[model samples]
Structure formats: C-alpha cells, structure tokens
Target: MPKFAANLSLMYNEYEFLDRFAAAARDGFTAVEFLFPYGFIAGEIKARLRDSELTQVLFNCPPGDWAAGERGIASLPGREEEFKRSIERALGYAQVLGNTRLHVMAGLLQYGQDRGRHLEVYLHNLAYAAQQAAAHGVTVLIEPINTRDMPGYLLNTQEEAHAICREVGAPNLKVQFDLYHCQIVEGDVAMTMRRDIAGIGHMQIAGVPERNEPDTGELHYPYLFGLMDELGYDGWVGCEYRPKAGTSEGLGWFRKVMSNKY
Candidate 1:
C-alpha cells in the first residue's frame, strides 16, 4: 500500500501550525508535509516532528511573496536572485528537518510575457536548484499545477513537467505528480502514472471540482492506491486536500484504508 502523508497546510486547520504535528500523529499519520516552513524556525518544526515521531516528507521552497499572490518566482524574469535565495533558505530547513524532497513551484505567466524566456529561466533555475540540493542528498521536484485553480501557472501537464526534467538533465530533479492537477488538466490519471512513474519523486491527491476529501470526489482513490502498489511506487502520497467538514471527521476514508492495511 502507498504511504500517505498528511498535508498540515490544508488538513488539521483546527490547531495552530506547530500544534498540528501532534494532532496529525494522534490521528495515525506517520508522516507529514506542508506548503512552507519559513514562517517558523526550522528547529521548532523539527522538534514537533521529533515529538510526534513523524517523518518530514516534503515542503516547497519560498514562492516569492505568497501574500501578494505570487505562486513562485523561478519562471519570472528579474527574480532569479530571489529564487536562489529561497532555495538556500529552504535547504537550510531541509537539513535541520531531515527532509529529502523539495517542491519548486513555477510562477505564473504575465500577459504578453515571453513564454520562451520563461521556459529558459525555469530550466536554468531548476538546474541550479538540483545541483545545490544534490549535495545534501535532496531531490528537487517540479509540479504541473492545473490552470483552472491557479490561472496562468507556468507548468500545466505531466508531459510538460517530465520534458522539463529531461531538459534540465539533472538526475536529482523529478516531477511531483499531483493527481488533482492531472485530472483537471487532462484525464487518464492512471495511464499518466504508469507512463511517468520513472520520473515521479512524489505524489499528491485531492478531490476534483471541490478539491475536498478523495472519497467525496469523482475519482476512485481506492483503485489508485492499489495501482500505486502494483506499479511499485514507494514514495509518500500527500493528502493535499481541504476538509468538507472538520478535518478529523473527513478522514473516514483514510481511517478505513489504514484499518485495512494492518
């Protein structure tokens, strides 16, 4: 069975950020992931993970100014320095937290912007990140987000992400196959998984349309979980979704799955 990582950024919002670690562990999550760790000191979060005995699976590099609506700055022009600085900061946290995977978000495209230039910058920046992260035994991941939820997002499909990975020519760089985004941009999530399994470093899932619990969505997650086992994918599958009701109440599917696993 695929190991599931509770996404604290979206789930368990009832508790404060630091307190969510224990909450997730109490609910049977052996591992956890979140959007960003910059808000708190690395040692503080590390202590929580240690206390909870939960593994830190993944987190993103800073995405420029998140509050100002910047998703990421790797693909944006004139922000290369800021992007590099973000990577350095993230690596410091990863070292302290014992995290090995880092998701690098590709920023949105502006109207009338040069697509080719953005691609160039993206490739260049990702290559740098891969080189730097490799020294720490970390793998840098790039995810193809759906344009519907994140309008103008630079990357949008699995093919595009894998192609970028190939062009970057860095072995440490891989794709974060977010099934939610894949379903929105293109159906055939299973087929895509099979085709790109080799390059996938991590996976994420959420319900389509509503982006709620997987059991509440059109996609049958049970089958997907089985498929991951059949394909020999041993990476953590991030539960990156919003809870329809309370976070704990919405975990019926997860609890059932865990019950069956043991």
Candidate 2:
C-alpha cells in the first residue's frame, strides 16, 4: 500500500496558520509536508509535530520571494551563494523536525540569461546542496513544475529533471516526481515513473487540469497508485491538492481510495 501524506499548506484553510497541525491531525493525517515554513520558528514547529505525532515527510527550501514572482533561485545563475544559504537554513529546520526530504525549487530564469549558463549554475549549486544535505541525512528533491500552472518556471518535465539528477550524480539529489504536473505535461504516468523511479526521492499528486482532490479528476488514481504498489515505491505520496469543498470533505475521497484495493 502507498503511504499518503497531506500537504498542510494546501489542505487546511479552516484554522489559523499555526493551528494547521492540529487540524491535519484531526483529519487523520499521520504525516505532512508544506511549501515553506519560514515564518514559524523551527523549534515551535518541531514541538507541534512531536505533540501531534506527525512525521514531516517533506518541506521546501525557502524560495527568495513569492510575491515578487520568484518561485525559487536554487538553480539560477548569479545566485549560487544565496541558494547555498537557503539550503543551510532548510537543513536547520529539517534537523529539528526530523525531516528526511527537502524540495529544491529551481526558481525562474531572468530575462536575457542564457539557458545553458543557468543550467550549469544549477548543476553546481545542486551538487553543493546535495553534499550539505547528505551530511545531515536529508535527501534533496528537485521538482519539475508545469509551465501551464506556473509559467516561466525553470524545470517543467520529468525527462529534464531525470537528466539533471543523473548529471548531478549525487546520492542525496533526486527528483520529486509530482504526478499532477507530470500528467499535465506528459501522460503515461506509470511508464514514465517506471523509467525514472530510480531517480525519484519523493512524490506528490493533485488531479490534473483542476488541481483538486484526486477523486474529482480524470486521472485514474486507483491504477496509478496500483502501479506505485507494484513498483514497490516506499516513499510518501503527498496529497498536494486544493480542497473542492473543504479539507475534511476532500479527505473522504482519500479514505475511500485507501480502503479500496489498488
């Protein structure tokens, strides 16, 4: 069976931000992930996780500025030093939370920048980040965001992501294979995962097109999850989707899926 985790950032809007853990726990989630927990103190968050008995499956390294339209800069040129600092900061939080995975968002590219040069910068930064994460027993994940949802995003395909991971050649560096984005950019989910599963360190899902609860969309998650089972994937599959009605209502679908045979 595939272990499911909830992305607290996207799931709960009913409670105050700091109270999300209690809400997620009430919803029956044993593990959770978030985009960026920069505002809260790491120690406080760790305490809450401990009290709640929730495992931190994954969390993102802080991307420079979201409001300024910057998704991440970990792979951008001229920002190597900034990117390293971001990784270190995330490591600090990960250590406290007992998190084993960190998602590296390969930010957006600046205008007039050569793609090749940017990729080279990303390669070097990733290698360095991987080394740092390895020392802390954390795996660094590189995600390929679909341009349709996030225009001008740096990485957008599993093929490119897989190639980058291979080039990086670090045990701690791997792809965060997000099923929703992959389904949007490229179908044939099972085959693609099978081909690149070796490089995958984490996984996430939302229904394609709508980005809502998995049961509300066209992707047959039963089969997709079945494929994951047959592949013997042992990583957490995060539910990173928007709730159609509410977090609790959306959770019913997850329960139904979990109860059924994949």
lDDT of each: 0.95, 0.88
The 10-residue segment of model 1 with minimum total lDDT is 253-262
Compute the lDDT for candidate 1. Answer: 0.95
List pairs with backbone clashes in candidate 2.
72-107
- Residue 77, candidate 2: Cα error in Å is 1.8
**Tens digits of lDDT, candidate 2, 1-262:** 7888889888897877778888888877889999888899998888888888899889999898888888988767778888989988999999988989999888887667688888888899999999999999999999998888888788999999989988999988999999999988898888999999888999999987899988777788888888888888999999999888888977766777767833
Q: What is the lDDT of candidate 2?
A: 0.88
Report residue 191 deviation for candidate 1 (angstroms): 0.5
lDDT of 2 at 42: 91
Residue-wise lDDT of candidate 1 within 1-262, one digit each (tens)?
A: 7899999999999999999999999999999999999999999999999999999999999998899999999999899999899999999999999989999999999889999999999999999999999999999999999988999999999999999999999999999999999999999999999999999999999998799999977898989999999999999999999999999998999988988752
Report residue 163 deviation for candidate 2 (angstroms).
Answer: 0.8
* Candidate 2 local lDDT, residue 173: 91
